[model samples]
Target: MLTRIVRMAFQPEKVADFLAIFRDSEDKIRNMPGCRHLELWQDADQPTVYCTHSRWDSAADLDNYRRSALFGQVWPATKALFAAPPLAFSVYPAGVESSLSSLPASQ
Candidate 1:
């Protein structure tokens, strides 16, 4: 599995518009092939900062979504609302099991 994170900083006034776009397209994004999970996170200290965390089956899967028409349309609009360039990164497992099953139980 691959995890992707994108940190977006939007104009304060444009945050609502950005969120509206997300609301309208989230389902389509989540339903994309190889998409396992998708979430939107907001920074408590910086209201204009938002992040999208998603898990994909592989890098190719992520690339497919990026190249899709849905992304082509949504990205341009989203980019226009940004206060700064977005930061994006991807990560894969470190060859260790990090699931809840590997953790000790609570008292």
Candidate 2:
């Protein structure tokens, strides 16, 4: 599995509005090929900061989404709300150490 995390810092006063934009965004990415899941997170210490954690089957899957209209619409809305350049990381999952006899719960 491939994990992609993006960190975004927004203007403090507009944080809620910015988050709303994401909440109301188009469904293009959600229906894209290879997208396993998508999640949104907010920093506990910094309310104006948010992050997106997504799991894709591969890098190519993410690339496909980026080139689609879903990204085209979402990017501009997201960028306009940013206070700083966003940071993104992509990683491959390492082995998990589990003690459960059956399948463990998802992280």
Candidate 3:
């Protein structure tokens, strides 16, 4: 499984517009093939900053969605509202095993 995260900082005045776009497209995005989950989050300290977290079966599935007509429509509109260039990346679980005993003791 792959997890994709995109953080967007929008103009203060454009936040509403971005929300409306997300509202209109969220379902379509969530329903796309290989999409397992979708969520939207706002930064606690930065009201105009938002992030999208989504899970996909694999990177190819994500790339397919990125090339779809839905993305074509949604991204440009979303991009136009950004206060800064968006940050996006994909990752998977490290599958590392660990225990509290491995940690340094607190003073």
> Of the candidates shown, which would achieve the greatest TM-score relative to the real structure?
3
* C-alpha lDDT (0 to 100) for residue 98 of candidate 1: 66
Order of models, best TM-score first? 3, 1, 2
TM of each candidate vs. truth = 0.88, 0.81, 0.89
Backbone clashes in model 1, listed as residue pairs: none
Off by over 4 Å in 3: 97-107
Give the per-residue lDDT of model 1 (tens digit) for 27-107.
Answer: 999999999999999999999999999999999999999999999989999999999999999998864466655679999
Residue lDDT tens for model 2, 6-103: 99999887788787777776245666899988888989998888899999999999998889878888888889888999999998855554334347
Return the lDDT, model 2, position 9: 97
lDDT of each: 0.96, 0.83, 0.96
Tens-place lDDT digits, model 3, residues 8-93? 99999999999999999999999999999999999999999999999999999999999999999999999999999999999887
Give candidate 3's whole-model lDDT: 0.96
Worst 10 residues of 2 by lDDT: 93-102
Per-candidate Cα RMSD to the true structure, in Å, reads 6.4, 7.2, 4.8
Error of 2 at 3 (Å): 0.5
**Residue 45, model 3, lDDT:** 98
